[model samples]
Target: MMTYQKMICDGFELNYCIKGQGQPILVVGSSVYYPRLFSENFSQHFQLIFLDHRGFGKPTRAFKQADYTLDKIVEDIEHARQILKLDDLIIAGHSGHAFMAVAYAKAYPQHVQKMILLNTATTNSQERQQQSLSYFEAYASAKRKHQFQQDIALLEQDLKREPERRFVHMCIRMGAHSFYDYTFNATSTWDGVYPNMEIIDYLWGVAFAEQNLLQQIHHLNMPIFVGLGRYDYLVAPVSLWDAMECTPHVKKVIFEKSGHNPMLEEPEYFDEQLIAWINEG
Candidate 1:
């Protein structure tokens, strides 16, 4: 069973959920879409805490675009930790959230016992962006051409018809291209997910443009586990190599048959690797 909780952190009414009962690990970022899908297995071995970042998941206080900086977001995590009375947690994040995990570990090294970065990169490079776009074009030209085109068309139509739902529609479209195995229904994956467009727009658009953590990651001396999907073009697989190069103490795994969400794509292997890494001394 999962227990929902809330706290006032850094002037934001933060919402979080707790499950299982062992070593505590805080999983942050983008819980709006498929929150449970990523951490279901980890819950068995660890007390997984999931939190909705500022401007997301119904925060108590409204925020401005200037409030979404990496530093402020990290501060929110720390404030929540202090409020919850958690000690030396294992911090984990996925995609851009994984970048947040890296930044958090860098700023508050004393508070984090370990760090887990999933399907993420250190910086958003133009080379990576081009490669991702090229991969998508090639993918669309392949056997799934018709289906890919249809998904894009549907996404564009949704954006025009319901601009407020742009975040949801964008995620669905991105998931279609991000996943290697498209057998899973995209809409079903997005079920129960509530996205805050304002948060997505401000953070990813404005703040991320000025954010880069490559130089700071080397300062972290804690055990770091990085996972990347072979088919992940959104962030590019090369970013995994870049992360491994920058961080001194690190272990990496590549999900060959999976894409962005390896936990969902390859659960059994992901769980085994995660447990073994956590137990390693």
Candidate 2:
């Protein structure tokens, strides 16, 4: 692993951690909720670059929802590429960031060599919203209310002192949708309140209002690989399976013992799968 480096893009100082060498693989982090999970877990295989999008992480800017959108995210990514002097990059994303990855491939198909999606939803509109609601309902039903409240209490106690604490609480309720697992869950206590305002708005918009990338998946000119966690609370594994089977350009692997945050849950296992996909590419 290497030291964390900072890069300036669009007037914002983006913080990222890089490691290894060879083909550049830029990781689009999941909005604000869990920013550093993927970069820390998968930095060994490729020249991994994990960045904190605007309003999230440690960016020197205030939270702004209008600036949070797929188009803007794509722009930031291109700026990052320019800074890195990367021509053929492999882009990967999880959760909401996945939409940005797929959309970027759609907008600039020639720039990206490959893509990796983890627990992503390519569908737009009511389908995604209703499905997410169902996922949370199922998760809620399976767990005890007291336990859920306990988690919330932990989160509140931990983040209450942070400046952006309210944003974290909002992000947790919105991103996780109060659908928590009984056994494995990361609270604001463990990770603190770090949801990016832009990430939240963009994800909510695309998941509820915006072609998302469902129709655009077929348009990708690069090899696409999907990593799905077997017990993901946010996105069902079957969703990825169906998407892979439906898209001729997609290859998929399932992490049988993992949940929504596979990279965090099983780092070595997740990296192995990513390496296998890159080698296949």
Regions of model 1 farther than 4 Å from truth = 30-34, 125-127, 138-141, 239-248
Worst 10 residues of 2 by lDDT: 173-182
Q: Rate the local accuracy (lDDT) of all candidates.
A: 0.74, 0.64
Candidate that scores best on TM-score: 1
List pairs with backbone clashes in candidate 2: 32-196
Cα deviation in Å at residue 38, candidate 1? 3.2
TM-scores, all candidates, are 0.89, 0.78
Q: What lDDT score is found at residue 197 in candidate 2?
A: 51
Clash pairs, model 1 backbone: none
lDDT of 2 by residue, 165-210 (tens): 5555544533233232444444553364355555665665653256
Total clashes in model 1, counting residue pairs 3 or more apart in sequence or in different chains? 0
